[model samples]
Target: MRTLTTRAKVAWAVITVVVLVWALLPVVSIIATSFKLPSQLNLGTFWPKTWTTTNYEQIFAGSAKDLFLPALRNSIGISLIATFVAVVLATLAAYAIARLDFRGKKLILTTALGVSIFPVISIVTPLFNLWRNIGLYDTWLGLIIPYLSLTLPISIWTLAAFFRQIPWELEQAAQVDGATSWQAFRKAIVPLAAPGVFTTALIAFFIAWNDFVYGISLTSTSAARPVPAALAFFTGASQFEEPTGAISAAAVVVTIPVVILVLLFQRQIVSGLTQGAVKG
Candidate 1:
């Protein structure tokens, strides 16, 4: 690798710092606000003069728990279920799309592309009425089903791209060595595709977890409302008080799982995304 000149290195460092600040500003602001006292909320600075954990305390040990905890559980359950279903279905469909030859394959892919890009707001109204008619409104299943529409197309696309890079010869070679079809697939093909599947699951989970419009528009109660929507309804100490600190605290709390998830699986995510980028 060639070394960068001093001027080029300086320019790159400045760009990196700018990008990092731009990306992390909101998160940092949320974290900083979460630790601020209610009186210091509008201090017009990043850090608080008198830090307090009252917002977190309220969320965890007070009445807010009734709303926050249930919503947290709903978010976790819904996102996990959506991710599992989306990843499984996407894997099968991706394998077929990448390896099989069939009529209208391009059409199916094009349809998926269209559906994925379709504005979700346009359907919320019709889906709201349809879900109420079908008895699925205000239910976890209601959210999970809609989340699939958002997640499936991207999952299919990503997994299909990654699947194309895998060598089918490995599966055939395993079969020739007396392995059964299932065994060969599980032991040979799956290992190669696991990173892609994992990456897809992460993507699906994030999509489901961060969903706000559906979480709010589809559910009226905490019974099915997720953390994102629940946070919107958080009440402050009094009617006149702003829930900014509580909102920030809740935001920080919800973000922890995502941070942990990325920290744990970042290597797999990077490998999956870059799997087909370089050929040697």
Candidate 2:
């Protein structure tokens, strides 16, 4: 690598600091607002005049119709189930595309890629009708199936790229040692693909957690509504007023798990992204 000039290095450092502040400003604002009392927030400054936990206490006091807790539980349950199902199905599908030489494979891969490019609105109506007929409407299963449409293609594509990077000779050698295809895959391929699997699961989890359109359009009851759907209640047409501080508190609550997941998987995400780009 060539050394950078002093001017170039200084300019790059300035750009990095600018970008970091740009990205973090909104997040810092949200967290700061969440800790303020409703009265303190009216002052309109970056920092709160008074810090209090009443916002969080009110949320846990069985007020707010228990919306916060239920929404939290629904989001976690749906995201975990959807992520598990999507990752398993995607892994198998990707393995076949990467390792097998079947007819129509190219067409299948192309179609999967095409599906990923389509917007969710394009099929929302049809999916709603189908779920209604099957009696899965407004149910966790209903939400899960639709979430698969959002997550599956991307998961398959990510895993397929990773699978292709593994040396073919390893699988061939396992076969020569009297292991069946499935056995060789389980014993050798799966372990090597752990990082990719974790990356796919993280993507699926976030997609399911953050989804709003289908969650709102399909579920009519609060019992089945996730955090994204529940957050809508904070905004009312008659703005006599909902507490901005409380809404910010709820947002902070919903964001915590996602932030934790990203931090925990930061290394894997970086590795998977670089590996996929370089290998594919």
Candidate 3:
């Protein structure tokens, strides 16, 4: 490998530092704000004058528990269900797309891409009315339905791309060793696709977890509302008070799962994304 010149190294280091500060400043601000006393909120200081855990306590121990806890449960339930369903369906569909010759394959891929980029707002109004009429509104299934719409397309595309990179010979070899088709697939194919499946599951979970539009628009109560929607409705300590600190605390709490997911699966995610980008 060729070494970078001194100037190039210096420039890259500067860029890295700038990007890190730019990305982390808002996150740091949220954490700092979450620890601030209500009286210290408007002090305009980056750090709290007197740190307190009141905001976090309010979310879990105070009146906000009714709203936050159920919403957290709904978020967990809905996101997991969506991720599981999307990955299973995508895996089968992607295997077909990657390994079989079928009519309309290109059309399916193109449509998937188009739907993934489709403006979600355009259909929200219609969906809202339909969901209301169909009795899915304010229900866990209601949110999961639309979340599949968001997650399925991307999951299919990513899994299809990953599947294309899997060598079919392994599957065939298993079959030659007297394994049935399903056995070969389950034992040979799925194991090789584990990384891709995991990465896709994480992506789908994030999509459903972070959703605000459908969560807020389709659900009216904590019954099925996720955290993002619940955060918007967080109340202050008093009628005259602002909910800024409490909201920050909830936001920080919500972010922990995403950070942990990324930390745990960083390598798999990177590998899944870059699988087909380079040809050997």
Question: Quick one: how many clashes does candidate 1 have?
Answer: 0
In terms of lDDT, the best-performing candidate is 3
Tens-digit lDDT track for model 2 on 1-280?
A: 9999999999999999999899788988988988887666768799877888767776666355377788778778887898899899989988898889998777866777788778888778998899889988888988888888877877887788888877867766898999999988778776887878889788767778889988887787766788888888654213665557667788888888778878888887776666544556
Q: Would you list the rank order by TM-score, best first?
A: 3, 1, 2
Off by over 4 Å in 3: 1-9, 177-183, 271-280
lDDT of 1 at 115: 78
- Scored by Cα lDDT, where does model 2 land? 0.79
Q: Give the deviation of candidate 2 from the true structure as CA RMSD.
A: 3.0
**Candidate 1's residue-wise lDDT over 226-249, tens digit each?**
999999899888898998888888
Residue 172, model 1: lDDT of: 92
Q: Count the backbone clashes (under 3 Å) in each candidate.
A: 0, 0, 0
Residues 122-218, candidate 3, lDDT per residue (tens digit)?
A: 8789999999999999999998988988889878888888888889899899999999999998999888888888888988888889899999999
- Candidates 1 and 2 compared by TM-score, better number: 1
Off by over 4 Å in 1: 263-280
CA lDDT scores, all candidates in order: 0.87, 0.79, 0.89
Instruction: Name the regions of candidate 2 deviating beyond 4 angstroms.
Output: 1-9, 174-187, 235-240, 271-279
